[model samples]
Target: MTTVALLDYGSGNLRSAERAIAATGAETIVTADPGTVLAADGLVVPGVGAFAACMEGLRAVNGPRLIGSRLAGGRPVLGICVGMQVLFDRGVEFAEGIHAPEAADEAGEAAPQAVGAPGCGEWPGTVERLDAAVLPHMGWNTVEVALGSRLFAGLDPNERYYFVHSYAARRWELTDTGRIAAPLVHWAEHDGCRFVAAVENGPLWATQFHPEKSGAAGAALLRNWVATLD
Candidate 1:
């Protein structure tokens, strides 16, 4: 049987994610062991809460090295929620709100207000607060699936997935260098501002939404990804 390793770096709903993945018929193990993480047929990196904090936890367990090692060898990896945010270059979490700026310093210069946390840098782009009237873009939402997206394959265009997030990658910055294929980027909107909802780039796949809590649509998406595992 195929085995999937869920990286336990003191973040995410491990049991829920494990159960969701296991439902796809793959043997899922929640482990922080380096050996198990690298040797597994597929790896899931799930995260919640603040971006910088998640990075700190991931670093404690040498997650960056393990994930890099697996991807370097063309092994598959999946990320969810803040897990997906950490995959980007940076995550800018504001202290007050998106529109609120900090008071100027004594020198009459604007003080740095936002907490700009660095991410894993697997992809180019910054995960920042969504420009919307509402606080968090909670509840169900639909995504515009990318062409040739193995991740969103067989999913209906109108299929809605559960999303509970405030910050997200507002744009896809990575361009085709011709040397390698461009990544398949999926977009979703919240109050007119669109953001990256999912990404499928070679061996690495991720989603900003929680698949484990997304009902039937989420389950089907998990199944599609699990089907690609060896």
Candidate 2:
């Protein structure tokens, strides 16, 4: 059986994410312990609230190394919402609650604030702030997955799912399927902006939308995530 590690970083939407993963019948371990994470077959990092605060939690629990190890080991990892963005190099722009123009005033140019923490990343992907669409990108929107990914398993062509995010990924390429230890589907575009809806770099599958809140199509997506372990 697939051992799915449902990470609980104190303030998180633990129960719902757990239910989504559990529906796949994988063993779900929701805890603050890093050791439990290291031992798991698959890892799910689910988060809500501010980005900086979550990073603090990930650091306090020694999640940096724990998660990095899993990613390096090619263990399946799933990141949702803020969890998805966390995998990037850094999100100083959003974390500071400032826009690019404002950030430019702070620095010479629009640059991400580098965190001194060990586990925190520099936010490898890009961040797209769309003006035409509403902020948070709330409600249902169609997700045009890159192509051929476990995250989009059993999904019909041109499927739609719910979303809620003000910022979207500015850049992220689809992982080379062959070398993907935690493969990802990257930077799906909607309303002229590309966003990282789901990413699989090998064993990891991360999405910005809440699969648990996505209903039937989401349930099928979760099942697909489970199938990858087989």
Candidate 3:
């Protein structure tokens, strides 16, 4: 049986992700141990709330290194929601340094705040807030799947997945390293702003939507992800 590790970095919808992956007939373990995380056949990173807080939690358990190590070895790692956002170079939501320093103190010294918090950097680009009238783009939305995508395999093109997010990658950052194939990108639009909804790059896969909360369509997506493990 494929043993999957649902990384517990003090964030994420842990139980839901666990039940979802388990339904696919894979043994799923929710843990924060570095050893267990590294030894798992597949790793699932799920997160909720603020990006900076999530990165702090992940660092508490050395999650960034764990994920980096896994990806370096070409192992499989799946990120959901904020978990996916943290895979980028940086998140612009609560970014620091851009703001001017506070007023000088009595001694003519200014208190400079820290710079922007870094992400896992597994992928290029920054996760920015969506430029939409409505705050969170919550509810069902359809994604335009890339041709020959394994993540969306066996699923209809017009299938709708559950989404509840306020920030996403505006555009994919594609670099020609001349070493690997280009990543397959999926796009979804809300309130006239289109954003990257999903990405499949080699052993790394991520979705902006919550497959666990997506019902039947989500089940199919999870099954497709599990199918790739074989």
Candidate 4:
């Protein structure tokens, strides 16, 4: 059996995530120990909170420095939601209202001019304001899956998954050449501007949607994730 370590960072939707993975018949362990993480067959860094809190929690639980080494060992590592955002060097969040949109616009413009932009941090890309039909993008929405990722296994392109978040990842357009993979984007309209809804890179997959809220299709997706364990 592939051992899965659900890194407990004090707060998150752990019970639901645990139940989803368990449906796949894999063993799950909630842990705050670094040794437990390093010994696992695969690691899942799950989170639901501010970016700074998530980062601090990871450090607190696993000494802050173990993440890179544990993840880089080639063992499968999955970061769900905020956990996924942390996989990048940094992320854009709404902790500060001042960061709502104008900040994103300024960051967008400064990317080319500055080697490193302020609000966007060191993400190797820039952030943009999402123009979705509704803001905070709650309820159910379907993702246009990127075929071959295995993350979307057993799900259709039009299938709607549950979401309850205001911020989404939109850091690709401003990226320098070779900095971004063939990015995957989902959409909605807010402020008459369209923006990225999700992103995936090699060995890393994340989404703002909570599978636990998505019903059977979501459960199957979690199972598919478990099945991929070597």
| CA lDDT of every candidate | 0.89, 0.71, 0.87, 0.60
Best by TM-score: 1
Cα RMSD (angstroms) for every candidate in the order listed: 3.4, 4.5, 5.5, 6.1
lDDT by residue for model 1 (112-210), tens: 578998888888889998888675899999999988887877889999999988999998998862327688889999998899999989889999999
Q: How far is candidate 4 from the true structure (C-alpha RMSD, Å)?
A: 6.1
> Which 10-residue window in model 2 sums to the lowest lDDT?
114-123
lDDT of 2 by residue, 64-85 (tens): 6778788777777788887877
Q: What is the lDDT of candidate 2?
A: 0.71
- Least well predicted 10-residue stretch by lDDT in candidate 1: 98-107
Error of 4 at 97 (Å): 4.6
Alpha carbon lDDT of residue 48, candidate 3?
89
Model 3, CA-based lDDT: 0.87
